[model samples]
Target: MTSLAFLLPIALGMGLCGLAAFFWALKRGQFSDLDGAAARILIDDEEDIHP
Candidate 1:
């Protein structure tokens, strides 16, 4: 019982913090380009180095 009293609030607080961060990101445009990100990695922008 004592341990639960100590741990439950900590667990809930952590969960709420994670939810807040996720919502914050959702409000921003962070997740708006899901498909582009997958396609972007396949592009090769490297150029030959001049010696």
Candidate 2:
């Protein structure tokens, strides 16, 4: 009973912090080019392999 009182607020606070961080990143354009990274991996720009 006493443990619940302590744990619930802690859990909610952590969840809110995570949400805030995500929004901050979003506003800073962190997720602006989501498709760019995925497409880059598919195109291999390999140079010559001369021994």
Candidate 3:
């Protein structure tokens, strides 16, 4: 149908936009430190301020 013709391009455009955004995040190092963040959460601060 005619609706399919219009929707197909829109879907493809959205997919391409998502791919571009993912690539941009890669270039910006967004996925570079996945493990460090998890480790940071487990780290405990030993500083005692309740003197």
| Root-mean-square deviation of every model | 1.9, 1.8, 2.3
For all predicted structures, in order, the TM-scores are 0.83, 0.85, 0.82
Model 3 lDDT at residue 13:
100
Q: Against the unseen true structure, what C-alpha lDDT does each candidate score?
A: 0.92, 0.93, 0.94
Report the Cα lDDT for residue 12, model 3.
100
lDDT of 3 by residue, 1-51 (tens): 999999999999999999999999999999999999999988877674453
Question: How many steric clashes between backbone atoms does each model show?
Answer: 0, 0, 0
Candidate 3 stretches with Cα past 4 Å from truth are 46-51
Using TM-score as the measure, the top candidate is 2
- Which has the greatest lDDT? 3
Backbone clash pairs in model 1 (N, Cα, C under 3 Å; residues 3+ apart or in different chains), count:
0
Write model 1 residue lDDT over 1-51, tens digit each, in one string.
999999999999999999999999999978998999899888876673443
* Candidate 2: clashing pairs of residues: none
